[model samples]
Target: MEMESDFYEAALFHIDRERKLYSSMPSRHYHNGYEIFYLVSGDTCYFVDDKAYQVVGGVLMIINMNEIHKLVNSSGETFERITLEFKSEFIEGIFPDNSSIDIFSSFTKGLPMIKLSGQEQGAIEKRFDTMIHEYTQQPPGYESYLKMLLFELLLFIYRKMESNPRPALNEANLVHKKIFEIVDYLNRHYDEQHTIGQISKNFYISPSYFCKTFRENTGFTFTEYLNNVRIKEARNLLTHGTDKISTIAESVGFESLTHFGRIFKEITGMSPLKYRQNYKV
Candidate 1:
């Protein structure tokens, strides 16, 4: 979706599983803002950047700008979630010195998902309920009240993270941790050429095992995942920058402009220039 300034400075959503039977698999997407995703009930698999995480109710998934992510139902049972999306500027505008709030430190450090206990979940949910009510009511000074509620919720989560260290946010298997390290490296170095052999050697694993583990964990082959990351970056530049198509291609690690053009069109259904023109705000 195109970024529109007036669309929503900040917003919240409550999605229930009963309403998803006809909903297609959402296209994996990223935005210019941050997202706080809380699973209210049921089970789901969340794919963030490159690793797939199995998350249960009461887990909070944090997403920063340019991180491609999506959710898929992992169980047939009912599911529900509350999502809050906001621009960094919106928060800074409210509290001039908002750097003291470190709710997103873990997210920036690559630990995006955190599991909360029953009591903690209830406390956070109550604040969200209040915000939703105020939002719907649109009472005088509702915005100020909503901001205060959000700040309190953020502080609560921050304290929880500090007090309870090493929550079981993902699988504890050694292989899972190893693969996550590689995925993290790929995300940080997507502009450089990477090969399975080279990555395996760097991680001191055999190429065969690296290939198998990466696919099993991310649901995408190494080459496919790398290309997806590169293309996502290309899309970001196309929509928000003045870079030339060739420059964007090379900067994102595509050696050939023809190959970049083909893949870009296949993934986004439009040429680079066309996409930039169509989506530029």
Candidate 2:
């Protein structure tokens, strides 16, 4: 079962309960607003930027805007989750002017995953239930009520994090640890030229095994992952810098302008020039 609500483009809420295993993970992507993901049951692997987390039931993952992430099932168990996404404007004026707190700071600082205790999880579940009810029923002032509920939820999490910080989740296997290290390396050096064989040699693993493990853990082949990292950086440059398209292409590790244009369009659904025109500030 799945339920979803979109509030005037500023916020979105979704709940999904799946009884069967997912044949494939969702495509890697990022959002324009902050994302709050609560795993209600089962287990999964969550990749956020450079690190991969072994997320289980009762874990909440916060992803900042434009941070690349993906979730893959870790086992054949059924799973359920609730996701809330909201732009900054969605909760504007909720905070007092003199307050020193930034409720959403968790999205930017510290570990992205939070492990909630049984009691804490119950509290959060109640807030989600209320938000869902208000959204579905559309009672008087339901929109405002929903916003308040979201604010309360975030504040509760923020306070919990402040009072008792949890350690980061460890990789479940040695192979996963090594693959995540490779992911970190790739994230930092995406603009440099690389080859699977070279990376495997540097990381002290057989090329074939590296390819298999990388794909299994990250849901992307070596080449695909490299291209994604490079393209992700390329997108940032296109949006924030005044570099020429060819320069941007080469800087992000594409050897050929034509190839860059082709891949850029393939991944982003538009030519680089068009993307720049639409998104450049």
lDDT of each: 0.67, 0.71
Candidate 1 — what's its lDDT?
A: 0.67
TM-score of each: 0.52, 0.54
The prediction achieving the highest TM-score against the true structure is 2
Give me the runs in candidate 1 sitting further than 4 Å from their true place.
1-25, 97-103, 171-281
Residue 267, model 1: lDDT of 60
Which candidate should be chosen as best, given lDDT against the real structure?
A: 2
Give per-residue CA lDDT, model 1, range 33-61, as digits (tens).
Answer: 77788866444667777767755455688
Q: Give candidate 2's whole-model lDDT.
A: 0.71
| Model 2 spans > 4 angstroms off | 1-20, 23-25, 165-281
- Poorest lDDT segment (10 consecutive residues) of candidate 1: 14-23
Task: Report the Cα lDDT for residue 50, model 1.
Answer: 70
Q: Total backbone clashes of model 2?
A: 0
